[model samples]
Target: MERELPKQVFIDGCEQISMEFEPIGFRFAKSGPHASRRAGDWAFKISFQSNYLNVGGEYVELVVHASVYSKAIKEWDERSAWPASASDWVAGGQLGNLRTPHHWRTWNIVNPHTRQAEIANIVANIQTTVLPLFERFDVPRKLAEQVACSQVPGFMFPENAVRFVLWQLGPEAAENCLSYWVARLPSPDAFRSERDVPTLPDRLALGSDTNNLARVARAMKIGLSL
Candidate 1:
């Protein structure tokens, strides 16, 4: 059988958070039922994208979509600005979802008084975890290499992370940079002659040991076209 809808604790959690994580700007687009603020194509502070609130505020699911580069809203930090939705700005980028996502959640705590503490913990975890990802790779090549090498025995990225980093290296080098990410493979078995390699896949298929490199080829083709 399926799980129940949002739990009562989650509902209370949403009520507590609505005050802090309010939807701030224009409504450019709707990502599921998220509350988004937008400017042209740029959107941020989108909320409720992954969680739900049931009738009477009786149940709530711990859904969140906090962006890593939110600090940009206050001041300019060029590295954090990515996946620019609108055109370039005089002060640099005003909007981005640059890195892949990494969701943070709070577990159920039936006690009413402790809900605030749970929310605080979830926020703290996200703040501490996010920026370091950007620090690891300044260029897309480094990112592509990291994604390829991430298959190490103990390696694990945040659950919300994009399997492949979605960076915006710009037209001058975007195609070249995104191209490098496609060459990585699951195993040396992929080092076959072009005629010997089977048809390349059209999309990324996680947990598939084989055909990964082939999928990369297709990712490059599609990414370049975009």
Candidate 2:
């Protein structure tokens, strides 16, 4: 009744990307098995919560694989071991012994049809999972508005099924959030919105869609009181 997992999946996207995409690729807080795959059916799921947000979603049936001709990295390796062997920095020829990288890992999100509805759903899931987390982290409302405005691209399916996406926010978005906001580093003002706020779902369909990243940035800037 179900297909088996593919031998492997390939990610397609910018080879060297920023950290803005971590929210979509790696799980932040919530933890569970990565998406499952089968032979006839191509399905995957990612569940992670930024200290600021939590997201969970699934693609029912799609053609999941690494990019055919793109330079992107899949979540796992040929052996399915994350944090690829080469991923580790070689400082002084030592492994796992070096300053942490600047940003989180990246992945290219792949879908079957690359349809607006599908992209909308993925973005919606991101918004559903992340907005509240950002709210929780006191990310400026304005910055959030900006991000929401340009979350998805207008095009066909990416070469890879679910490769990395850029996670690096513009300087404006990171200013009030992290000291070295390029990565997951904490923000001096990150906790400003620690107070009660809307649930992830409520925040997903919030505003008229134009005020998301901007409002989020603003909220983070002044430490909006949720």
RMSD of 1: 10.6
Model 1, 110-173: lDDT tens per residue? 3446657767764454334422333343443565445443431112321112223333323334
RMSD of 2: 19.2
List TM-score per model, in order: 0.43, 0.18
lDDT by residue (1-226, candidate 2, tens digit) is: 3432222111111111112344444222212312211212122223321121212122222221110111122222233322123221100111111113312322222333443354354344434443333232233234333432322221011101011111223333334332222122143233333212333221212342222322333433322432
What's the lDDT for residue 216 in model 2?
34
Clashes of each: 6, 58
Worst 10 residues of 1 by lDDT: 87-96
**Candidate 1 local distance difference test against the native:** 0.36
